[model samples]
Target: MMAPDVARVESAIEQAARRGDFDNLPGAGKPLDLPAAHDPDWWINQRLASGEIDSQALLPVVVLLRKEFERREETLAALPDERAVREYAEDFTQRVHQDRRANPFQRMLAPAWDPEDAVARWREVREPRPAPTAAPTPEPVAESRRRRWWPLRRRG
Candidate 1:
């Protein structure tokens, strides 16, 4: 037997469906199949699979999954086995490697260009140098070595 609130929600959903309110609604929170663009391992293996994502291109996808996980983390943690998480992570890694290999130029160019070195070189080129100024004149030492002030003096 369903709870009364659940039954009421079901009825409302059914009514909404009948009235075309839910007819063309897309799966708003569903993960994109993303076999090629987002899940390159799936693209490489030619089998679409649900998994973790760690690619820069798939950052948005990861963010969405993270939000979902955060929302349902307790439920996920309560599951008997966490093997699925491992499997998913492996699948994501494979996809990312496959995607990385697809674009040889990007892989080659990324490491070839060093932004940090370029910035350092630019600073070296544009650094300001101190202006030429007259040498500092040293004060003359007193010829006599007499004490400037007596050790003790009484005021009159």
Candidate 2:
């Protein structure tokens, strides 16, 4: 009942086996190393573990938003000025609002970031710490009277 192409392939494989083409190959006669509990997303997990793909790519929009919220400091710090930070916060808030509106039934919704709060936080993080008190100036050291060493003869 096999298709002609399949039967031909099977026959060719059999001939190759008989000819010892697959003998002594790597992992011959060994059982495959499979996990005891099958994971449906094993390939995805493998890629994530090996960093072949970005982890954020597989995250839900809400989760991604939450992660962004958590790292807002770093993101805002990279911006050149307060205006850029304010714009970023506004954009982030808008996206959160949009996502909430679009996915009303989603179980885990990311809380909307307050643009004012974000700006405040950015300012707080950007504020320069009070300059440390200047250390007491060290007393001037007396010049040493030791003669200098040199190989050149005095031309006097």
Name the best candidate (by lDDT): 2
lDDT of each: 0.50, 0.84
Q: What is the lDDT of residue 53 in candidate 1?
A: 38
Cα TM-score per model: 0.23, 0.54
TM-score of 1: 0.23
In model 1, residue pairs whose N, Cα or C atoms come closer than 3 Å (at least 3 residues apart or on different chains), thus clashing, are: 40-95, 41-95
Question: Can you tell me which runs of candidate 2 are displaced by over 4 Å?
Answer: 1-33, 36-38, 131-156
lDDT of 1: 0.50
Question: In terms of TM-score, how similar is model 2 to the real structure?
Answer: 0.54
Residues 107-130 of candidate 2: C-alpha lDDT, one tens digit per residue = 897777676787788888888989
Q: Candidate 2: lDDT over CA atoms?
A: 0.84
lDDT of 1 at 21: 88
Model 1 agreement with the true structure over 1-156: per-residue lDDT tens digits: 999999999999999878978655576557755544564466534331323333444444434444443443343343343354444434544544454566545422112213344334334444576899999999877769656675677799
Cα deviation of 114, candidate 1, in Å: 19
